[model samples]
Target: MSFYSGIDLHSNNHVVVVIDEEDNKVVDKRIDNNLHTTLEVLAP
Candidate 1:
């Protein structure tokens, strides 16, 4: 019941993805580079 996340950061935006323990993708998104936006997407 655990999850893992990875992000590919760029100057203007970021590509983020999250996967479960079984390696199934749970979340996939492209978000602004802004810190608040990133945090919101990552929030539980």
Candidate 2:
């Protein structure tokens, strides 16, 4: 299986989305503009 991710960055917060090869959404969230938070969201 393959996965892809996209991030919509903003000034204070950002939107994160993860999808599979079939374009099925795996994870979708809005998180603060912090390194740890971003990493946690992106982690499988």
Worst 10 residues of 1 by lDDT: 35-44
The CA lDDT of each predicted structure is 0.92, 0.92
lDDT (C-alpha) at residue 44 in model 2: 70
lDDT per residue, candidate 2, 1-44, as tens digits? 99999999999999999999999999999999999989987877
TM-score of each: 0.88, 0.92
Q: Model 1 TM-score? A: 0.88
Name the runs in model 2 displaced over 4 angstroms. Answer: none
Question: In lDDT terms, how accurate is model 1?
Answer: 0.92
How many residue-pair clashes does candidate 2 contain?
Answer: 0
